[model samples]
Target chain A: MSILVDKDTKLVVAGLTGREGSFHGLNNRRYGTDLVAGVTPSKGGQDVEGVPVFDTVHAAVQEAGANTAMVFVPPPAAADAILEAADAGVELVICITEGIPAHDMLRVYTHLRRDERTRLVGPNCPGILSPGKANVGIIPAHFFSEGNVGLVSRSGTLTYQIGNELAQRGFGNSTIVGIGGDPVVGSSFIDVIAQFESDPETELIVMCGEIGGDEEERTADYIAESVSKPVVAYIAGFTAPPGKTMGHAGAIVSGSKGTAAAKAEALEAKGVRVGRNPTEVADAASEALA
Target chain B: MDLLEYQGKQLFARHGVPIPEGRPAATIEEAVIAADEVGYPVVIKAQVLIGGRGKAGGIKLANDREEAERHAKAIIGMDIHGFTVHQLYVEKASDIAEEYYAAVVFDRGAKQPMVMLSRMGGMEVEEIAEKDPTAIARLHVDPLVGFQAFHGRRLAFESGIAEDVIRPVGTMLERLYEAFVGEDAMLLEVNPLLVTGDREVVALDAKVTLDGNALYRHPETAELRNTGAEDPQERMARERGLTYVKLDGNVGILGNGAGLVMSTLDVVAQAGGRPANFLDAGGGSKAEEISNAVEVILANPKVTGVLFNIFGGITRCDEVANGLITAFGSLDISVPFVVRLDGTNDEEGRRLLADADLPNVHVEKTMLEAASRAVELAGEAPPEDADRPGPSAGADPDADPEQ
Candidate 1:
């Protein structure tokens, strides 16, 4: 019943021969993800972690019926990898690679819009994981367990930390998706939040956001009008001063509107509980649940 | 990543765009010579990355060589919004009949390349956008179609550009778009594209920002970056491969995770303290990384105190503690340091710090306590080095500790 990915979800690791791809693929298998096949151009016959390798996503999907793809390709080649997976009808494409140029992602995003049926998680993100059912990308498998809440964020490492914090408080997740840290990601907080809202299994949601962009404001507006389920949000970059760009390309507060105060005000106005500390996020969720 | 207007014009000139003849000068003497070469009635613009240079007294018109030298001298050493002006650009001024604006930048919400054109130019475009947003014509260009002739024409017409100048305007827009995409620019602005008395369109001003991440692909653009405009701490951070940006505050922060670092900043503020800078040493940081981070923080005279907030996961807490201990020996850090280490091997992390027996160092259990200590220490003056026990003055107590 998990959204985006589950036990029945067959997965293919794009760029599986690379160090990061191989490492995650091996871990994916170990974590009980249906690691069906691997894709690396010109390495068709090679096998990684006993999973068969193919030359392209199309061939890999054709042979193994893989519906989900976890991409580990570098920045320059990430756009092509996404399009290849989308063209092959892979339902969910999770890109774990960071620093894909914004222009390249804009092209991929345009293509994704026309496709309609395919959904993407990131071009510079840590992938999604449905505890017990599937564990894709790099989130530690033990940090999450099957629960009624959904978690989504623009940060990779933060998502992992938040999930662990929630689990420690005995509040598990239905699914956790890291939408990525790039400014021009394929999907956003609103897209993931919408999916979580629609999922019957997800009774509540935790959204971790950073400074920069109108994504937080846009999501708040969306949640105010459409969402019925309670949302607990923790926005980062509050201590970040105006005009200082942070680590994530997306995490910049250039103007007055993009400041942390502005974002927190917008979210609070939407009736979403906003927590200041990482440890307080679960507590906020608990209060929202009540 | 932000290029000064003069540097951007240099890039535009390379792309065949008609930019006013200009050269950047560091001194009034050089500026006088440049003005002489460009002819009289030149424009002396202070070379800065920030906007609103015109209103900030950064841009001035000089009717003669004497005026040019005077303006250059005044503008070069002036401080506009915390950024000191070190260079002045002397350029041939254009005769203007009409002003137009055009730019190509990534529109995050649209997830596409957005082309913004306006009939109103040479003013704060943001204010115009707020007051009359529709006055600014925005078009999302398909990456496949790109900045084609038709796209440019549509943008020009929508901007209410004159019919006679539409062709040239469209052509210029297309060229600018090409420059934007080709150069991996985050922003390309040609403000006040002047239609002269003779009906010739000329770029009066140029501003461009190249994406730093894409710098690896464009080495030439990378070379154009002026490190003088950046804060010393920011420059140091870039060299160390750490994502650090200096802000005005007293409490200096060092953390492993970006999220944790950000949260720590908020925590500092919420606890009624201001963080001096944001420094993320990255995950799995060793002793040297911590020491380097400490050195950068110490380099800033604004940073009155130091705070180390680490939530160990893949990054072991003991590793950070050892780094802090080692930093005591390497750097003559006179400022107070408040350390908070939690998660993996927490006890060992605390034990390592305790064994170091360093003065002006306090260990706290919670992030709040550590932040409070940092704020408290920042409020007080640093203890005298002669009076305090130096690293060499103490015995190596943890020299033969169990692994």
Candidate 2:
């Protein structure tokens, strides 16, 4: 059993006619996800690789029975696309678009909180993949194998790197969620860890975090209190100088706070084994499961 | 992007927030002229981005032309916190009757815009919070509902703001909120919000940090990126559209993603070598982007060794190999390079590098081995003629280090 998606999911791709949307939209469909509909304003009658297209999310929901939305709209219009999905009563929205302004995300976040029906994943993230059941967003589904471990991270390629390492060690994942590296994302580490804890298939959890905010330290407290599943954590940016963003907008060290050593120490104090590298992370996961 | 004090005041003035009248001067002559125009008893403040300028003797009060010139001569070109002061902000001094603090910053844990107010100012907010938690009144504003007058009034009353200035302070909060939203600022702080003898509130200092991602919407503010104040290597990376941060070490580091690059730095440090810089070529980086990243990393004169750690996802190792080849073709590389390529198309990438058999370039299988090898190489004696002029060699001719 996966946390966010499964065989019962009916998917709709927002901005489906665009370059990235069409590419990954078809990729997800080829992976056997129930790609039901597409949304491209003023192009309702058109279709993208056998999926029906609608001008609005409401039409896609009413006619095609789309229960979920994967947004690839450009950064400027991406926030409105998510709001439109929520307005149309889509249960879950996953935004793959990067570079949406933080101010816009704040408004979208506040709106989603009030709406309460829709759960948003990312505005700048590689989407979730529950292997053998569903594939979503940009995660290379081939790297993952269906098993008992659950993976969540704030990075894209780094997540894939760890997945490859774990797979090499004979540890497959139940579900992999990329909550994004933006300062204000839809979900946090604790939010996804809680899901993994309740899932029957997920016996172990691996969390990947980087420097920036106190999210990792806070997640350490949450894991100590609530998560009974064995958790292995990896944090990055130990040598990062203060007040410089490495690559991702949120991957930075501000003053003396948000250092990787501090994060690793915090997780270790909570009885979690913090990996020093991706290979170490997989080894730690293997030890926990063993 | 942190705005200098003068730039922050300019932005505040645009948003109708009261700020002391000031003008920025790049030369001592201009500073004295500005002081003359602003009248007597002007403050000559160094226009540097780093904090603690006051403690560094970068700020001085002048009563007349002779004093203004002397202060400007002392402040200009002064090195404060490793940043040379190329400009001075001359402003008329204020007669303060009271001091307060106010700021609007994103509360990351709560995922909301937090408005903070405190009657205790002229000190670090952290000190205030630690000394007395209740000294600062905090309120989170929902972007959907927006900040309103009641939010400010509540904070004022909670922080025990004087009754006579509560209404004015509340109005100031509204304007500050507008500035925060309109300018796309991540942090807009007015420390020591001074209440003058005339019972008027004016911002004595402005500390603003705008969202770098949102700068595309603010072209005018985007142009305020002080090129003269930036590290030459960092400025080059910015121009090349690469996310790079300059560090003080010898092992130049490059990788595909932020997390991976950061991990590389940590691994290098753990292996007993300091990283020269952080350069993330980004996911799915094309051959050209990799070439650019290599150039940027090598441009740092402090780099004695290089490490390329790529964990391919969308970024294929073969493409990275091609980029490395291209860099070798274009650049006369002197330092030793250690490359660790894994994941998608990694074998192919390794084969390409083996076929090239480039001089001084070694390929390792894991991040640990590569970092260890790079550190070992960095500890070696430099090859003859490694010493060369840096990109910023002649950029600042007048920056006297001993000033």
DockQ of each: 0.33, 0.52
Candidate 2 error regions (>4 Å): B380-403
Model 1 over residues A1-290: C-alpha lDDT tens digits?
Answer: 67888989899999888987898788888988899999999999889868999999999888999999999988878888999999999998989887787777777888788878789888666678898988888776665799988999887657766776777777878999888878788788888888998999999999998887778888999999989999999988876765567778878765554566677788999888888877788778877766
TM per prediction: 0.91, 0.94
Which runs of model 1 end up more than 4 angstroms from their true locations? B63-66, B130-134, B344-348, B354-360, B380-403
lDDT of 2: 0.88
CAPRI class of candidate 2: medium
TM-score of chain B of each: 0.90, 0.92
Per-residue CA lDDT of model 2 for A33-70, tens digit only, reads: 99999999999999987789999999999999999999
DockQ of 2: 0.52
Q: How would the docking of model 1 be graded?
A: acceptable
Clashes of 1: 0
Q: List the residue pairs that clash in candidate 1.
A: none
Residues B26-141 of candidate 1 have per-residue lDDT tens digits of: 89899999999999889999988776778899989999988998899889989886689988999888888999888887767666678878888877677657566666777878
